[model samples]
Target chain A: LAKTTQPISMDSYEGQEVNITCSHNNIATNDYITWYQQFPSQGPRFIIQGYKTKVTNEVASLFIPADRKSSTLSLPRVSLSDTAVYYCLVGEDTGGFKTIFGAGTRLFVKA
Target chain B: DVKVTQSSRYLVKRTGEKVFLECVQDMDHENMFWYRQDPGLGLRLIYFSYDVKMKEKGDIPEGYSVSREKKERFSLILESASTNQTSMYLCASSLYLEGGETQYFGPGTRLLVL
Candidate 1:
């Protein structure tokens, strides 16, 4: 498991595009960047994942630079409901079965 | 949708009492995990079970033990609950993927040890 660094908290206005960045200085070559979202008492929910460049999804977009040292999670047209802690996890293929989460970035979408 | 069911949504236990947290996943995922969440500390894995009767210790397992009698059911045991053990416990299930795969989580079990 690689240690990740993300903002403790971020505030954004509704309908704004929110991008949260995570830095993994010692990211391994085999590691993949995965982000998860969680509400107050719920488990973190998977948002988007990427290995390099950019990967877009219906709910969010994951931007990973070529170096792969850092990644950003982009949520388009955020709403109040999008307020949650966003976690960035870096893990290798554990025979295809496990990913761990660190303290995620707390995202607050204001109206 | 994959449903990861945790037996208790909220639990209040006395110090030195034994506590058991049960999680069941309908998806029949190959892996099941238990994590505890705190205010400043993010999520910490306590234990994980990969197969029936197989278990592994995670980052924080000092006061925890886990059992996987069946693939779909994983249980966390607190031999003696303490005030420090009071926190929200989360259950998750996932299938292996080539890269890091997504993990689906349950609502959570809020345990209060007094």
Candidate 2:
């Protein structure tokens, strides 16, 4: 498993854009970058995933650099409902299923 | 939509008592996982099953055991519960993808042991 490093917390206001970066220096060639968001008491929800370059969905966009050692999750026009803990995970193809979560970045969205 | 349902939302157990945590998924996913979340430790994997009756120990498997008799159901058992085991228990299920697997989680079960 590739270890990821992200900020402890971030603050944003409504209608503002929030960007959270994650560093995985030991990322493997077969690893994919995936992000998940967790609200107060709910399970973590999948936000975006990408192998390289950029991938966008209805909720957010994932920007992966050419090196693939780091990735950024960009949320546009944030709202108070966007306040949650964001986790960046590097998924590896180990012929089996496994997921390890870190402390995660807590995003505080203010109204 | 993938729905993972846990047997209980909150549970109170006594020390040295056997505890069982049940998880069921409606998506027919091949993989199911049990994890415990603490204040600073984040989520630690306790056990996971890939197929029916096929189980694997995760990072923190001590004092925890799992059983997967059916495809959609997975159970985590604590032979002897303790106060230190009080935490938020989470269950998740996912399809087996090559590069990455997107896991859908349940609401979670907050267990308290005294």
Superposed on the true interface residues, model 2 gives a C-alpha RMSD in angstroms of 1.4
| DockQ of each two-chain model | 0.69, 0.74
State the lDDT of candidate 1 residue by residue for B2-107, as single tens digits: 9999999999999999999999999879889999999989999999888899888888999999999988999999999999999999999986666567788999
Candidate 2 lDDT, tens digit per residue, B38-84? 88677889999989999999999999999999999999999999999
Residue runs of model 1 more than 4 Å from their true location after superposition: A96-98
DockQ of 2: 0.74
Q: Which parts of model 2 are misplaced by more than 4 Å?
A: none
Identify the candidate with maximal TM-score. 2
Error of 2 at A21 (Å): 0.3
Clashing pairs in 1: A96-B96, A96-B97
For residues A8-104, could you state the per-residue lDDT of candidate 2 as single tens digits? Answer: 9999899999999999999989888889999877888989888989999999999999998899999999999999999999877654657779999
